[model samples]
Target: MPLQRDASPRMASMLLTTYRALGAAANPLLRVFHRRRVKSGKEDVSRREERFGRASVARPQGRLAWIHAASVGEANAVLPLVRATIERGFKVVMTTGTLTSAQVVAQIELEGLIHQFVPYDTLPNINRFLDHWQPELAITVESEIWPVMITELERRKVPLIVINGRMSEGSFRNWQRVGGLARSVFGALKMVVAQSDADAERFKRLGVASAVNAGNIKFDGKAPSFDPEAVQELQQRIGQRPVWVAASTHPGEETQVLETHRLLTRAFPTLLTIIVPRHPKRGQLIAEEIAGFGLSVAQRSKGEEITPDTDVYLADTLGELGLFYKLASIVFVGGSLVPIGGHNLLEPAQLHCAIISGGNTTNFAAVYRQFNREGGALKASNPVELAAAVERLLNSPEETEQLAVKAAELVAAGAGALNQTLEALEPFLRQETSRQRTKGEV
Candidate 1:
C-alpha cells in the first residue's frame, strides 16, 4: 500500500496538536521530579548514556530478525515469537521502551536473543540504530507506529510488519478523526497481523489494506518453566490454604483488592490474598495500604513467612510471576478493575489459574472477550462483585477446578498462532536471504 497523497494537512496538524495536548495533560509528576533531579546533578546523565551504550553494543547481531515491543506487556507477548524465530535459526533482536522490560529480557537467558532500548523515533537515531546491526526483517509487537521510523525503514526498503496488531476503540476513533493521515501512516507497513477480526476491520477503515487476523501472540505464550523442587517448596510453605493472586494490579485497584480481601476473609478463614502491583515501587505503598486495613500482612520483600492468620501477602519483587502463578488457585488479572487497560490474563490462564477480571479491559478486550465466551474467565464489575466471585470460587472446590481446567484448555487451543505467524514471515525472510546472496556475489 502506498501513502495517501490526498491526506489533509489541516487534519494532520489537528492530530499532532491533539497528541501534544494529551501528552502535556498526562505527563507524570514523577517524570517531572526525575527531570529536576537530573538537572540538579542528583542523577548523572553521562553515566546513564554510558550504561545504555554498553548494553546496546553488548547485543550480538547477525542475520537478525528484529522485534520491537513498547513495554513489559508487549515484551512478554513477543516471547513465543522470539523463541520460534530463534528455533528457525534467526538471531532475534528484541527492543523495548522500559527499563523493567529490558531487565526482564536480560534475565531470560535466550541464547540467540539480544535486548536493547529502541532508538528515539527520529531519522538520524533510527538510521544509527539500523547501521549498527541491519535486520533481515522488522516486526513490531503491537501498535507502535512511529511515522519517522517507518518512513526511514521504507526509504531503506526494509521489510516491516505489525504483529499482534490492535487498535483500541478509543485509538480507532482518534485515528478516524485524522482521516488519510492515519491511513498513510498505516499504509507504510508491509502487513498488519491483527489480534482479532474487529482490529482487522478497524485497520481496514484506516486504509491498512494488507491486514489479516492472526490472533494474539500472547495466546501462544507458554507458562514460564518452573523448577519442580521450587514449586514443591513454595507449596509446602503455602500449606493447604486457599490462595488468590491479584496479578499486575494498579494503584486504585490495589485498595479495592485489599478491601475485597477483608470482606472474603470473614467467610473463608484460611484464604490468602496475594497482591502483585504492576509497578514494584507501589509495593511499599500497597503494604502500608494493607496494614491500614487493620490486617497483619506478609511482605515478599521482607522475606516474611506467611501464617494462617496473615491476611495479605505483598509480592514486591520482579520476574517471579512463574512462582506466583504456580501458587495461586484463582487469579484476578488486574489493571482491569480500574481504567488502566488490562494486564495479560493469559499468563495466569496458561498456568491453569482460574481467571477473573473487571470490566475496563480495553487493551486486551478481544482476548478477554474470547476467554469469557469460552467459559474460561469470570468478569466482575465492582469490588463487591469481585469479592463475591472470589468467595464463591474459594468455597466451591469443584467450580474452581473446573474453571482452571477450562482456562488452561483455552490457552492450549490458542498456542498455534506462533506457527501461523512464522509461516506468514517466511516469504519476507526468503526475499531478504535472496537479496543478501545477490549482494555477496557482486
Candidate 2:
C-alpha cells in the first residue's frame, strides 16, 4: 500500500494508523501467498507455522538480542555482528527470510545462536514474536524496513539498531514518495550504522536522526570456509588445468561468461570454467544455455562429475561457493555485466584469488574502486574485454599470483569494522546486560 501525503502533522499520524490497519487486514492474503511459496519449494514446508509468529524452538534464558537479516547476502554480511553479539555474552536470535540463508546459518558452527523465520508484519504476528522472544534489543541488517513490526517493537520499547545499513538510490527515491510512512518506520530506530557516508546522509534526510557511517561490515566477515578433503579431491580431479570461476552470476551475464570461457580455452586448451549462478534454482536453465553454446556441462546439483571433456562446471548448489573459490586461481564476481548492481568481492579476495568484474558495480562501488587501484581486481566493461582479461590472467601465472596477493592484502587492510561496530553498540549491549543482572536473569 502506498503512503498518503504528509502535508500536516495530524495527516501523517492518520496515514501511519491507516497503513498499520491495512497491513493487519492483509494477513489472510499474506497467508495465501505463503502457501503458494511453500508449494513452489521457496518456503520450508514444515516450518510454515513460523510465518504466523509461532516459535519452532523454545526461547533460551537471559537477555536475547534479535538480529533480522532479510536473505542470504544480508545474513552473510551480518555474521561479524552476530559473532560480536554472542561474544558479549548475550544469547542471539538470528532471523532471516529465505530458506537458503537458513541453510547457510545451519551450516555455520556458532554456539548461542538460534535461527528462526521472521514472521510476517501483522500486529498480532509481531506481538506474538515479541512476546515469545522477549528480546532486549533488536538489530536489523541492511534495508529491510517492516512497518508493523517496527511499530510493535516501538510500543514495547525494545531498542532498535540498524547496522550495516544501506540505502540505495532506488530505495531512497521510493521512500521519498511516502515521506510520513518512511518517518514512521525509521523513526523507531535508535541508531542506524551505515555502510557509507552517502547512506548515512540519506537516512538522516529520511528521518533517522542517528545514522553513523561505519565501514561495510562485509569487510570484517569471516573468510569463506572450505572442506580440506573435498578441495584436495577436486584439485586432483582437475589435474593442473587452467581453472577460473565466475561466481554469483545473474541471468544475462551467463552468456558473456560462457563466451568468455570459450575464448579462454583457445589459449589454454585444457581450461575449465566454473559458473556459480546467483540463484541455484536456475541451474538447469544455465546448463541449457551452456549446452546451446555447444559446451559440455557438468552440473553440481545433479551429481554430474567434472571430467576432462567437461568444458563448464556448474556450481549451482547452495553454500558451496567457498569450494569453487578455492579451486580457482582467478575469480570473476558477477551481477555487474547487467544492471543488477553487484555482488560481494571480498569472498574471493579473502581466499587469495585474483578478481575480475564488469563495470556496472554501483553496489560495492567503493570496494571495487579501491581494489582496482590496489592492483587486486581488473575491470571488464564488455564481453570481449572480459574474455580477453581472463585469458591474459591465465597466460601470465606470475601476474595472477601477484594480483591474488594484492587482493588478500587489501582484504586484510579493510578489516576492523567489526571492532568499531562492536564499540558503537557497546552502550546498548551494556544496558541489556545490566538489566538482566538486576533481574538475576543473566
Candidate 3:
C-alpha cells in the first residue's frame, strides 16, 4: 500500500533536491577516498547483465535472491544468511560497496553465490542492473536506502526487504525533516528486520510499521577459525607476556591507542600491543606514527618478528583480524574512541576476549548498550579511560577471563537471529519462487 495521501509533490521534490546536492558533494569525496580500489584491479567497472530477462544472459537453473551490503562490516553480518540461502538451493548474488568487502565475500567460497560490485544507484545504471539480474527478491543490509534503486525495484514488482536495519538518532532526525518523502521511501520496503527495538521504533516513525526487532546478525556469525600451527608459533614467541589488541583502528584513534600503549608499557614492561588499522594502506603511516612515539615497532607485512623487547606489533595485513583477536586477552575496539561509531565488538567477544570500547558507539548503540548492561563489555570515555581499562584488564587476568566468558555467553545467546531472520523471509522467498517458476526461470 502506498503511504497515507500526504506525499505532496512539492515536498518530494524538495527532499530529492537535497539528496541530489548531498550526492554531488559525496561522490567526489568518496571517489578520492576509494582511489585505491579504482587504481587496483580489485574493482570491476564492466556492467554485467541483470539476473534475468536478458537475451544473451545465462539464467540460473534454480531460484535466485540478491543481497546488498554497504561495506565489510555489513557484509560480515549477512554471511550466515548467504550460507543459509545457498543451503536452501537459492542462487545468491551478494553485492558490496567496498573493494575490501568484495574480497571478503570472495573468500567465503560459497558454491552458488556470486559476488559483485553493486551498481551505482542512478537511473540508467540501476535500470541496466535490474533489467539484467532481474532478482526475484532484493535484501539490503543496514540502512542503505537508495531512492532510485528502491523505486526501480518497486516498479519491477520485486519484493524488497531490509535486514539488520538501523537508523541512528542523527539519521532519524534528518529523515524526519524530509517528512512525507522519507515516509514514502520507508513504506516501499516490504519488511524491515532491525537490530533493536529502538531501531524498529525509528522505522515505525518513518511509516514502516512492519519493522521487526531482529537481534543483530553480527552476533550470529561464527567465530573465525585460527590456524593451530600459527597460534602455537605466536604463543611460543610471546610467552608470559600480557597482550592486548586494538582492532580496526581508524586514523585519529590509532594515535590515541598508541599513546595508551605508551602509558601502559611503563608499568607492564613485558606488555605487547597489536595494532590493526582498518585500512591496509594506513599500515605504513601507523608504523611511522608509532616510530615518532619512540617505540620499537615491528610490521607484520614485512615479516618482522616481535622481539621480547618490542613494544608494538603492527598487524597491518587485511582479513587477519581473526588471528589477532584470537591471540589477545583483551581488545579495545577502535573507531569508537574518536566518534567513528565503532566497529563490530562482537568479533572479539566471540573469541572470548574481554572487550572495551569508546563512548561513541552510536552505530551499534543498542548492541553495545545491551552488552554494557550485561557487564560483558567496558566503555572508556577517552584516551585516559581507554589506557586505564587496558592496564586494569591486563593486571587482573581473572577478571579479564570472567568478562570474556560473559561476553562470549552474551554473544552465544544472541546467535539464533539468523535463523529467525531466515524464518521471517520465508513468505517473501516463496512469493519470489512462485514468480520465477511462472516466468519459466526455474
In order, the Cα lDDT scores of the candidates are 0.77, 0.86, 0.80
| Model 2 lDDT, residue 204, Cα | 86
lDDT of candidate 2 over 84-154, digit per residue (tens) = 78888788999999888888888889989999999998887888888899888899987778888887778
Whichever of 1 and 3 has more lDDT, that candidate is 3
Lowest lDDT 10-residue stretch of candidate 2: 1-10
Which ranges of candidate 3 are over 4 A from the true structure?
A: 1-10, 17-62, 433-442
Residue-level lDDT of model 3, residues 1-442, one tens digit each, is: 2333455758786776676566555654545544555565345434222211122335466677889998888998888888877777688878887667877887887788887678666555567667667788899998898887887787777888999989898888777776788776777888899888888988888878599987788888868677778778888888889899999888898889888887887888888888988877677888999999998899999999989978899998878888888888799888898878988988898888999999989878888998999999999987788889988888898999999999999898888778778888878765555456678874
User: Which 10-residue window in model 3 sums to the lowest lDDT?
Assistant: 47-56
The TM-score of predicted model 1 comes to 0.85
Candidate 2 segments exceeding 4 Å error: 1-7, 266-269, 433-442
Considering only N, C-alpha and C atoms within 3 Å, which residue pairs clash in candidate 1?
none
As a TM-score, model 2 comes out at 0.89
Pairs clashing in candidate 3? 50-132, 50-133, 51-132, 51-133, 52-133
Instruction: Give the distance in Å from residue 285's predicted Cα in candidate 1 to where it truly belongs.
Output: 2.3
Per-model root-mean-square deviation over C-alphas:
4.5, 3.5, 4.0
